[model samples]
Target: MSLGYFSYPMPVNEPVLQYAPGSVEKAALKKTLAELKKKQTEVPMYIGGKAIKTGKKVRMHPPHEIEHTLGFYHEGEEKHVKQAIDAALKARQSWAALPWEDRAHIFLKAADLIATKYRTYMNGTTMLGQSKNAYQAEIDSACEIIDFLRFNVHFLSEIYKQQPISSPGMHNRTEWRPLEGFVLAVTPFNFTAIGGNLPTSAAMCGNVVVWKPAHTQVYSAQMFMRILKEAGLPDGVINLIYVDGPVLGKVCFSHPDFAGVHFTGSTGVFNQMWKTIGENIANYKSYPRIVGETGGKDFVMVHKSADADVVATALARGAFEFQGQKCSAASRAYLPSNIAEEVKARLVAQVQSMKMGTVEDFSNFINAVIDERSFDKISSYIDNAKKDKKAKILVGGNYNKTEGYFIEPTVIETKDPKYVTMCEEIFGPVLTLYVYDADKFEETLALVDGTSSYALTGSIIAQDRDAVILATEKLRYAAGNFYINDKPTGAVVGQQPFGGARASGTNDKAGSMLNLFRWLSARTVKETFNPPTGYHYPFLKES
Candidate 1:
């Protein structure tokens, strides 16, 4: 069944709700959190409409308050992974044959469900599972995910409407077809929006998906799966699983039915997957599409003439929000010696004023890093910097994980521009700075531009138009999502379609038509009218 050449509504980004104290949204969120606290749910690996129990459970704990158990989820083995792939392939025929309008409606309705009924539920789950505060959860789990769903459906219609013009005697058109086999979506723990978008984007274009969500993110992912099912997503359309990375990689790469992979994670993992796919290239039905966004050693450069206050606030918000877990988070900074003290003073105040604790306390600006492994890794970087002669602890290098994996927002200043912390990606709330002579702005720009292999996002703060133009021109390739005076984080859908090149994976800008195009393989169809019975062409006639 199909709707009659339906035109979709104009897409608008969902506004992020500020969950301030005493507001209705805040009150609703609190009530939902309380209700969730009373319930201990068992999340199971889902396959072909059945919840399969694997006998091993991974307990879910709030990263901010690690001792408190929110719930636990079953862990899957090879059997379950193969089962998910089998189910998706089995459903591929009917699912792919369904009308595009039918597939579009399911996701469009899911967008509304996330916006209205499932708002508080997803928010509560993201806060507990990811340690995001109320406002953070609102922006990520609810607002951004809703935008991804609505905008993707809108873009699908736009793709289908694109047709080729033909001459008077002939008619020509193109049909966009989904991949012949399954697409695997491997999502990250940082953004709940990413977890949902990666899989649904492929499936919305009429492909089957076997999604393996990060174990740490599975709690909220389970909630998202429930939302899709409620929104009328058919069984076997998207199969959710929980398994070790190597185990899944072995099975997925070797299968002749592997068609594509939509991934967002570490750079190392993406490269390894690429190698495996290349080795098994001869086994696949088609050359699979590989789309990924990986680790970023993102940066911010502040000119001497820039506003110190604006620079300070940008550093505070950009580097520390969501505990510096965003792929675009500004991790390294270059400040001129002229504004060094003023910018440093203002940034210190911002960090000191921030409250750090559990998400239950809405007032807390900082929460724990994702888990203990991350906590230890970030601390090691700080500890190494503290002992190094070239670096000095500027402010906030404290860490305590007695009850939770908590680390204070840290800032390290270095005389050596090549300090370890300045180049490596810590993936936590650690920002490093290198002050340069005001006269050497060009040199400093070069340093900042070349310091990292990853080029996901970066920003320049300047009032000087010439300086701004210079920075913008020189550092153009340094970041995919470049900023003028604003910070590097907080890229909205539609406006700033996000992704990066170089070591940051393929720069397939998500949340846009370019990303939707990746899932479809187009075929051109041509027909001739008033055909002559003779096969000879007019060009063959002898003059």
Candidate 2:
């Protein structure tokens, strides 16, 4: 059956007796909420110039609860990945030949289309498909994607216009241009924004892309392609392939025509792909570019002078947002001993008050973890933490896998700051709490740095100006994103560039000029009004 957009009932009409003293305000709010809930759809994948119902099928269930099968989609196989790759390669010559301005038009129109018809669909998919709550799915993931597409279009134009001279007298100049081949974009399930940016950046730079989206978010990625097609993107310009990772990895590494790769996933997978490409490098016509954002062990530091309330709230969102699947999630939090109890109280209160349910309800604050594997991993981690002499499970450590993948938002307190959990990338709604003596601020900073193999994100909370400045400068190498008063995961498009270095992989800095550069190459073309005399060029032939 063809799937229409996903829709849910409005969260209106509370029990009259339970309704607060503000009846007039409540009535008005319900009216607006109803209108918004009415607009949503579940879109399908579009590949090779058209939307296709796959030969094989897989049932998609709500990440929150597995009782009801939300929908089933065509399970793309090895053949589909190759077909998509061929489509991308087939269209490359013509697409890359288009003027830069024309290429920019597709992205600009895509942004507008996304801001319109795709918004509700995108939000609904995030909720049901990825286990994100309504507000978090719609407002954060979907909105940020639209904003990224718009801002990146303008940035690409600016990059094109920049010209610097190589010499004063000679008619020599350098120009940045697109790589004249295909880019294979392998994305993650964490954020919708990264999904759009990974492949679209290459498309914006006049390169056709074969994009393999995360299985959990195939629908979200499909809707993205739909918006671009609606925006008048040329057929075959950007191909969407829905195959499993290992199969797609083979095609990407083996294809001699492939020019670049933009990947976001685990460090293990990234290294394997890199090795595969290296093995095939000699046979390829050109040196293929690899850009990636892998795993992270993000941290949050609380100074003695910081407000406990703010730290609690920030840590709540940082550790629990999208159930902590984000690369920038605060996996480890360090607080001063003086404020530890107060911060713990506030965090416990907030978490306890939050509602937990599936996306269909649209009223819950917490939703499902991703799948059975993720649920198992997180639950096992919590179990293992119990065996550690220095570890204690603080708030939640519950897991329910009889249905969909569900894990309670858990917090663990460790006696030693260097506990193994504090050093690793849990990549779930699991937060490790560490308390340090106030005087050992520097020592605590070094502790986090030493423990983590990843340097993707780290933040320090402090009211003092000097403290904030010192933290920023001292921990410069610690994070691609560093937060002060706000949460770390919500990095805006134009303002903050995302990604990191060290084991976190390439610091491409998505949504900034740095990432746009990765999709492009350079060229020089000169036409001298007066032709130079034959022999001598620069220092050659005895000038």
Candidate 3:
């Protein structure tokens, strides 16, 4: 059926576009945003390549402007989850049997579509639905998602080429088969790229997927599903559904054919899923592969010789961008006493300068958190800090929810190194600072490593080469993705494959070949060119 060995060259990362004032991209994005706000559309679940609409509809609203209606999506019940699984199993064999090059081109076409025709729609939907600013939306919904698609195709192709060596008398080869059954992709709302990558990565590996995105992210998620269909993805290959997490898990986890899950969410939820899967291990055909990137209490540590401006800028962008909703957002900082005063002054000024409002205004660097529940959770931490005597507000501790859930970028200075905000993850626009003696760099590194159970991401900013080396070795396991002089966030796809370990996650390193390997099962084939008359080995007959 196949002629020659195929090679897909390594792909370069997609370039991020700047939506500057008076630029063509800026005008196009603004027009797209305006159009999206004016229309209210109805969305349905895609199962087995058919659009299925249940009467139960949930309204969609923008986080920054809750009053405005974006659209409504049909919500499904337990029966629908079962239906999705059945459809996936029905389509699994045909899809897995198709040539790998054909599968690779479908996703490659989808990436090109995102980069060109539907670029604005992707960015616009993300900006409005997720309350992300123009640049954030461009980087996430457009560039990052594009990079994930292209790079994954190349990575999976490279995986197929790996083979075992053979001796003179025999020829050996390996067949990389897709997992036996279906994969479940549970994605979060913060990044549209994560929502796209979770499902497509597994599907690109010849696995059928049952995708359930966060309710808050359905607006953009549906757009991507339509794009996949247009890119020649067959029906039932990736079934999109809307249902409660418990109900979805009840059906998928207990099913005998459930093969794996690709997840991105909170730690508690991931823990519960693992527990349920373990409890139901006897029902499955094979051991399920569970890969997840959970929560992060990411940090930034400044050395005595660090530049004050660099430290200030890193905190400003890392802590406040996307309203600090990123799992990798810098939630805590350890500033040495030598440069503490200057860094504090500069950071306070930067925080004060930020304008918070809707995502339509490109000038506003801060936007609303995801929803009311997230808003309440983030604000409660700030309220508790106001009452505690050990902590004082450095700047920006105000919040309002009249028109939108807007919380100013709040910074807290604490005398206690182990304060609640420092240790716990408050996924919001809040940063807590703890200053230590300049001579206690090593001691503070230990404190930083010991403070949080999460080791997802952290940065060490310093001009002293020795200080950088010291932090690098001492805190080797402190973070899965470590940074120097730069912010802890903004990991590029091929250059920096992202994921973490400990309570953070399994650290499978998504956006790399390592993640793709989880979706495959290999079978080795060995053929003997010549046969002997007797069914006996040389050692048994000769000596």
Highest lDDT scorer: 3
Can you write out model 2's per-residue Cα lDDT over 1-543, one digit (the tens) per residue? 214422222122111122134554234334433443454334344666977677576776667667666556676777777788788778878887776666666776776665555556666666666877655665455567776677777777677667766454457655676775689998888787788888888888888888888888875677677778888788888888777888887777788787889999999999998999999998677898899999999989888899999999999998898888889898899989989999999998887776777665545677888888888788889999878889988788887877677777889999888787898788898999998998888777777667877889888899978778878888888887888866677676667788899889899988777888988888877756666678756777563
**C-alpha lDDT of all candidate models, in order:** 0.92, 0.77, 0.94
True-structure Cα RMSD, model 2: 7.4
- Per-residue lDDT of model 1, residues 1-543, tens digit only: 765898886598898888776788888898998888888889998898788887799899888888888888999998888999999998888898998888888998998998999899999999989989888898899999999989888888999999999999999999999998899999999999999999999999889999999988998999999989989988998999999999999999999999999999999999999999999999999999999999898889999899999999999999999999999998999999999999999999899999999888899999989999999999999899888999988789999999898889988899988888888889999999889999999998889888889999999999999999999998998999999899998888888999999899799988888999999999999999988897998899898
- In model 2, which residue pairs have backbone atoms overlapping below 3 Å? 5-41, 5-42, 6-41, 6-42, 66-404
lDDT-sorted candidate list, best first:
3, 1, 2
Model 3 residue runs over 4 Å out of place are: 540-543
> Which scores greater on lDDT, model 1 or model 2?
1
Segments in model 1 whose C-alpha atoms lie over 4 Å from true places = 1-3
lDDT of 1 at 390: 93
Ranking the candidates on TM-score from highest down gives: 3, 1, 2
My TM-score estimates for the predictions, one after another, are: 0.99, 0.89, 0.99
